[model samples]
Target: MSKDKKRADLDEKFQQLRSMTNSTSANKASILVKASNHIRKLKDKIEKLNQELGSTSTYPNTENEHQQDSFPKVNVETLENMFTVNVESEQNCPGLLLTIIQVFEELGLDVLNAEAACNDGFELAAQGVWNEGAESLDAEIVKQVVIEAIRKWMSGTASP
Candidate 1:
């Protein structure tokens, strides 16, 4: 059968399974299991079709690629006497705190205290004081430098 015809048939089968699952009956659990299996097969068929059409994505077509790109949010805040940096990523990035310390040193900032924690991803907060007589260093500049340093580390161009 042609690809279009095959896809249509699979979609019809999926609808039938869905309807079976929704019906109130003693065999609902069995119907649900069958529906799950059918869904998996349908997904595989769709993936194969996508591959044959020259798509390069390895993720299933149902997943949103943009959502995957929206992670790893970074923020920097500088106070009158201290600077704070915050990072939220999808995965824990090792040596991130050390890299922040290194960036602080490179920017002539004194590390007064730093703390980092992680659960699903990572959250790093670094507090520091500017070097004495460094009147040029401000919140915006410090934030920019910290952000750039983290970006470099994430891109593998820099290390802790």
Candidate 2:
């Protein structure tokens, strides 16, 4: 099928899904399951379309793609023996915060506090403490590693 036709069909299906989701005639569980299945089908169709178009990026590019940088802001601060990491992103990329937490865990750091929020964008902040006698837990190194990991993830080059 042509891309335009496929997109139009997908849009029509989405509208049907939205109507079903808002309908009061059916049981909520059944409606939810139907909606979920529709979403999965839509995702699969989108991926197929992307492949047909020879696009390598996982997410579709928005207009003005060159005008905005999607790279999230990452900041690391050290106070005494504690390290605080803050991340802000223009979009709510799924699993970003969890990946950051995993980075700390993989580095043998104890996360004392962690929080994430999303409105129009995503924000994650975490505080961690190193073990009393642990070596190679430098704040700068940890910060760099986290930054690199997030960059790789954003670029769709990270391992799943």
Candidate 3:
């Protein structure tokens, strides 16, 4: 299928997910389970597309056609509402720490604590405090921002 057609289909499925998620009507156990399963499948499809499009990069450019910057990978394992970010970088450039701290600050999240490995490898260990009463975060968005930041930092555009 064409990219546009695939996008449209994804959108349609996403709208169905939203409707089902927000529905107030009484639903049978099977119906709710099916709806949840459908949403999960849709999410998987989106993830596959993201991987194909190099969504982790700052942006894919057709002109460059040969950009070698791959998105930094991150792992977040949390038991509660708190999340711990572990960013891994291959080049380990300068100012990446500051950029990450600034991202949290700009989002109004307080940096409760942070640590990083020295020049040998680029890895940041950070804990952030979100608003006590704020809405829950979108995990995908958080991951995307961190990955994109790492990509930018790797590209040597570590400017604030």
Q: Which candidate is the best by lDDT?
A: 2
Better of 1 and 3 by lDDT: 1
Q: After superposition, which runs of candidate 2 have C-alpha atoms over 4 Å from their true positions?
A: 1-68
**Candidate number achieving the greatest TM-score relative to the actual structure:** 2
lDDT of 3 by residue, 43-101 (tens): 77556646743674433233452333434457754433466777765655578788877
Task: Determine which window of 10 residues in candidate 1 has minimal summed lDDT.
Answer: 53-62
Off by over 4 Å in 3: 1-71, 78-80
TM-score of each: 0.50, 0.53, 0.51
Q: Give the poorly placed runs of model 1, Cα more than 4 Å off.
A: 1-71
Residue-wise C-alpha lDDT for candidate 2, range 1-94, written one tens digit per residue: 9999999897676666557444443454666677787567646655554454454442334456552467677778876468888988888788
Report residue 101 deviation for candidate 1 (angstroms). Answer: 1.1
TM-score of 2: 0.53
